[model samples]
Target: MRRIIYDVAVSRDGFIAGSNGDVSIFPHTGDHVDAYNERLATYDTVIMGRHTYEFAYQYGLPAGAKAYPHMRHLIFSEGVQLPADAEVEAVRADFTTHISALKKEQGGDIYLCGGGMFAGLLATSKLIDVLRLKVAPVLCGVGTPLFANVSERIDLKCISSTLHESGVEYCEFNLQ
Candidate 1:
C-alpha cells in the first residue's frame, strides 16, 4: 500500500505559515531546500486542501494550473472552480473512500501537502502514515498551525533526525 506522508515544513512554534498564510519565512536556501527537492521524487501524488492548492499563487500557479507539475494533484474542495482540462483535479469522491482506494493502488507514496485543518482531519482519522517534518528555527507566533484541533495525541516514533546547516531540523516520524 502507498503510504500517506504528511511531508511539511514547520516553524519552531508549530505554525506552517504566518498569520497571512505567508510561508516565505522558512529558509529557502542551502541544504534544506536541496534535501526537500530530492524528497519530492518519492511521491507520485500530491494531496492538499483547496487553500493549499490555491496557495500556489505565490509560485505563479494560476487557478487552472497543477500544484505540482509531474505528480497527480488532488484538491479537496467543494466549491473551487477550474477548467475542464486543468492539471489539478477536485475531490469528487468520498474522502476516506477515495484515499483508501488510493492506498491500495500500486505506485509511489502520496503526500499530504497540508494547510493544518485538512491534515488534522486525516490525523484524527489515523490516515496519516508518517510525518516528514522540516522544522525551521524561526517561530510564527500566530499563523496557520502545523497541527490544529486534533482529537487525540497521535504518538509518533522517530525514524531519523538530521540537523542541517541552515538551522533546519529534518525529522521523520511514523505514527504509532
Candidate 2:
C-alpha cells in the first residue's frame, strides 16, 4: 500500500504561508529547494484541498489545469467544475473512503499537498503516514498555520533531519 506524505514548507513559528498566502518569506533557491524538487519527482499523484488548488490562480494557473504536470492532480472540492478535457479532476467523493481506496492502488506514495484544514483532517483521521517539512528560518507573525482544526495531539517519530547552509532545516517524521 502506498503512504500519504504531507510534504511542504513551513515557517519556524509553524505557518505554511503568510496572511495573504504569501510564501515570499521562505527561501526560494539553494539546496533546500533543490531537495524539495527532487522529492516531488518521486510522487506520481498529488492531492489537495480546494483552497490550495485555487491558491495557484495568482500565478496564472488556469482553474482546471494541473499544477504539477508530471503528477496526477486530485483536487477535493464539492463545487469546482472543470472542463471535460482538463488534465486534473475535481474530487467530490467521501474523503476518508476515497482516500483509503487511493492508498490501496498500485503507485508511488501520494503527496498530500496543503491548506492547513485539509492536512488537519487527514492527520486526525490517522491517514497521513509521513511528514516531510522544510523549516525555513523566518517567522511569519500570522498566517495559515501548519495544521488547522486538528482535534488532538499527533505524535511523530523523527526519521531524519538536516540543517542546510541556507538556514532551512529539512525534517522527516513518521506519524505515530
Candidate 3:
C-alpha cells in the first residue's frame, strides 16, 4: 500500500504556523530547505485541507493550481470551489473511504501537505503511515498546533533523525 506521509515544519512549541498563519519564523532558505525540496521530488501525489491549499495564495499560487506542479493534488474541502479547468482535484468524498482507496493505489507516496486538523483526522483514523517533521528552533507560543482536534493518542516509532547546522532537526517516524 502507498504510504501517506505528513511532512511538515513545526516550532519548538509544536505549532505549524503562528497566529494568523504566519510562517516567517521558519527558515526559508538553508541546507535543510534544500533537503526538503529534494525530498518533495520523490512524491507523486499530495493531499491537503482547504486552508493549507489557500494559504499558498499569499505566495502567489493561483487558486485551483497545483502547489506542487509535478504531483497530483487532492484538496479535501466540502465547499471549496475551483476553476472548471483547474489542475487539482477538490475532494468532497468521505475522508476515510477516499484516503483508504488512495492508499491502495500504486504511487510512490502521498504527501500530506500541511494542516493540523487534517493531520489530526488522519492520525486519529490510523491512516497516516509516516511523519517527517522539521523542528524549528523558535517557539510560536500560540498558533496552529501540530495536530489539532485529535481525539486519541497515536503512538509512533522513530525511524530516523538528523540535526542540521541551521539548528533545524529533521525527524521521521512511523505509526506503531
The best candidate by lDDT is 3
How do the residues 48-129 of candidate 1 rate in per-residue lDDT, one tens digit apiece?
Answer: 8888877887788888787677899888878778888888888865877778888899999998998798899888878899
Which scores better on TM-score, 1 or 2?
2
Q: Write the per-residue lDDT of candidate 3 for residues 10-128, one digit (tens) a residue.
A: 99999999999999989987789999999999999999999999999899999989989899999999977899999999999698789999999988999999799989888888999
lDDT of each: 0.88, 0.92, 0.93
Give the CA lDDT, 0 to 100, for residue 136 in model 2. 96
Per-residue lDDT of model 2, residues 108-142, tens digit only:
98999997988988898899999999999998999
Report RMSD for candidate 3: 0.8
List ranges where model 1 is wrong by over 4 Å: none
Pairs clashing within candidate 3? none
**TM-score of every prediction relative to native:** 0.96, 0.97, 0.98
